[model samples]
Target chain A: METINYQNFRIEAENICVDYNGKVALYDANLRLKPGQICGLVGMNGAGKTTFFNALTGFVNISKGKIRINGESLRSAQKDQTIAYVPQNEGIDSQFPISVWDVVMMGRYGSMNIFRCPRESDVQAVKDAIERVDLTDHLSTPIGNLSGGQRKRTFLARAIAQRASILLLDEPFSGVDIRTEKLISELFIQFKKEGKTILLSTHDMIHVREFCDLVLLINKTVVAYGETSEVFTPENITTTFGGISPDFLFGPES
Target chain B: MELFSFLNLDTFITDPLTHDFMRKALLMSSLVAAVCGFLSSYLTLKGWALMGDAVSHSVMPGVVVAYALGLPFSLGAFIFGVGSVALIGFIKQKSRVKEDTVIGLVFTGFFALGIVLVSKIKSNIDLHSILFGSPLGISLSDVKQTIFISLLVVILLSIFRKDLMLYCFDPRHAKTVGINVFFLHYLLLTCLSLAAVVGLQSVGIILVVAMLITPGATAYLLTDKFDNMTVISVLSAIISSLIGIYVSFWLDLETGGSIVLAQTFIFLFAFLFAPRYGIFKLQKLFAGYK
Candidate 1:
């Protein structure tokens, strides 16, 4: 497999807003992510975290403001394969007949030349990704037959196979078991060591403190974003959660 | 003895090939079935069965207009087929009307206009052929035309099969991988139109929709893997087309209706008896899940 040149990938968003049929879903959402850092996006339900991710990934049209990746606009960055995203609660249709290997192979489709089949390197990368996610035994199993945790790992493996410098995950740990979360954390640590940038959303504040180097508290807009130690305070938590954080604890015990 | 002669398998299979019209009908319908089966795999997977019906019916006006202008039927069919989809998209996006309602409105309106025009034109063209197929009337030129269009559909679909499968399976993932999902959407739509036009030659509008749906549906009940489903779909179509043509010859029935009946029979068999997904097995499957 050819070596992927891991450069200093950075994403900068300014005053991003998204409107869904006249209803505002996000407003003035701004954040900057530097390479080799893990940022946790903390937000309440319906707080536009997924919408923000969608805007950043160019999946949804940004009604206002601009986002740049590695100093290039989101559109251009997307064209160059600088970012990859894993959506939350991805319930693949039960009748879909693709295997785990094929799902992971799709990550290489973007980089492959038109009319050309997947090269040896592409196959190698896919194999390594599957093995990394501990899904080597289930390589031939139909994706729809996999358990929830297995499915999430399959998608994460796809992102790994994509070889993108920047990764955006929406609620990566939602509904997954503790073992799967631990496996993912280890993988993220390994990715950070290799200089890959990651931004993920989660409600697990304890995991956020343990794994995320930076935190972005959001509720329909940017509330606070900085190093985790400075930004993940009780006051920021209350503000981000719309005053619902009074019952919550600030320390790891909560 | 005479009443039971229709059950004679030897004559049933051999008699159809004796007449030139019957031979042409068999060849034309087989080609149509092959193409439709290939397309139906994706159509059923994506739940575009209704969309197939919409495009098939909506092409009626285009067919009539093509005849009036001396243009190719496929051209008119393709135009109107794509136009209906665009109209549906427009209404669904611009207004609060749901997609199914928009589809129902656009296709029926186009079909009604076609009926009015056909009634007013006073042409010698048989309206029955346009609505319900006239396989026995297929000429050498029609054979050439059908083969050309079917070949194009086959080649393009084969080359882009993987991409199209991924597109149908998970469009969001396809988009994330930098695929032009809009292009894939229209490409699939265009394929549906082409298949409809091609099937229009042998099965007409109503039966074309059947050919676009039943073969793949039957195959779906047979396999869990899509690649297997596609192969099974094409095979089922060819087998049913041959048997339908032969049975129609034996029974002196309408060719297109017989073909659809044969397809329906196969679907029923698969529905009741398939190993993994049949109604019988579904009981056991659900019990296991419980």
Candidate 2:
């Protein structure tokens, strides 16, 4: 494979392959995301979207691939806090005795001292992130007391506070309210304006069409990827979803 | 009126301190309880109550080995406690068996080995003292050992409280931001082992798990903040230790059993009467709706 100029892209994955105990989860997956692009990762269930995200964050070892974030190795990029990840909502212990402010403050933990005592700048960043998510009223509330949408916003706030150049979100819209959806959409537009790279996985075709400028379809590997207008065709959707053109895609494209 | 005479202020509070052994037991138990209370918050929050039980029981073989080698009992107990944790993790990862099953298997095996060693050996290692504790007969050396271990555990836990909290609460997030999850995992296990060794001196192997669980569980029901939970847990545990020591002295009861009973009673009280999360409060709130 030819070596691409890593400086031109915020995230670069070349022939990424992941194997879980000899079972192939992702194979020969390749993607290059430039700054200021919102790439929608569209795939079916068990299609390795989460696996790809895990690979990017260095959570899972890549069996055969080179991944560079902002022209550096994944570990160096993570150390520099170049990427922020908002994982799906299922794994978090909501009943944990933590406030929304504390959860958001976790975003700044990398910048804090060994004791994690927040500096003035860290506190200000946490406040700004919470404000961006419009969760100021519930800042001090225990995370368990929040509604589902509020809980999603709290994690989003943590990601926003990270102030990283690249953002990776896994199904950020699942099970959230309409108000939260609108709020998140607005944030995405603002994030793009700020020239931050974003890669989000979602099942909602409407959200893909409306918000994503670039679309990458995958079924264990990259099926197609390009500008949304060109790549997000019915054929691509059908191929990605294993031969079924989802009903949502047939809806009038706005 | 005569039934309440045991509660006389001087006889209950002042009499026990006069005896050198009673004073040492009181001080050692309180120190052990305070450290256990502090760790309980993390243990309960991480859902490691069973893990605590496993580590405590696993230390028995180490204690016996240390005795046979003429070594410090805490050293042997600490090694086995940490070893069992690592062994459990290894087995759980290398095989398909669930974590709880692995923990149960490994701890019981180590405990049974300790029992077998006790029967086979001819040393002065009193099985009763090791199992039920010898708080009433605590030596000065035991007092110093408990103080040193408690201070060490308390200092490390205080310094890393927030980092440990983040690790326990959202380890995935902790990893994404560059926190060393593996190091923190082992660090917590090591601290738990240290806490278990300290607990062994006061509550013995059988009841140390209670010292490491009930106070934290009670405080968890009482608060919505980790900081507050630690404080409440420490206070409750210390109070229980002091009260149990006093009552045991006056009533001629087993000291370790009495302390654990005091902890259990407090936990029950919190379960029924905690301001927001209490069972009765939730019941009352539901009744209002009906």
Which lDDT values do the candidates have, in the order given?
0.86, 0.89
Error of 2 at B150 (Å): 1.3
DockQ of 2: 0.66
For residues A1-254, what per-residue lDDT tens digits would candidate 1 score against the true structure? 33434453488899989998778999998888777889999888899988888788877889999888888877677667778887676545656877899889888888887643899999999999999999999998987688878888988999999988889988899888878888998999899987788999988888788989999989999899999999888889988888866355454442
**Which pairs of residues clash in candidate 1, taking residues 3 or more apart in a chain or in different chains?**
none
DockQ of each: 0.51, 0.66
Off by over 4 Å in 1: A1-9, A246-254, B282-290
Model 1 per-residue lDDT at B191: 91
Q: Candidate 1 residues B1-290, lDDT tens each?
A: 98777578776677668898888887788888999999999999899999999999999999898888888878898999999999898888888888888889999999998899899887776799988888889767667778888999998898889889888887766676677788889989999998999898777887789999999999988876788999999999988988888887777888888888999999999999887788887657667988
Query: Which 10-residue window in model 1 chain A sums to the lowest lDDT?
Result: A1-10
Q: Write the per-residue lDDT of candidate 2 for residues B1-290, one digit (tens) a residue.
A: 87677678866677678898888888888889999999999999999999999999999999999999988888999999999998998898788888899999999999999999998886988999889888888776767778888899999999889989988898777777888888888878888999999888777899999999999999999888889999999999999999888888887898889999999999999999887888787657767898
**Which of the CAPRI classes, incorrect, acceptable, medium or high, describes model 2?**
medium
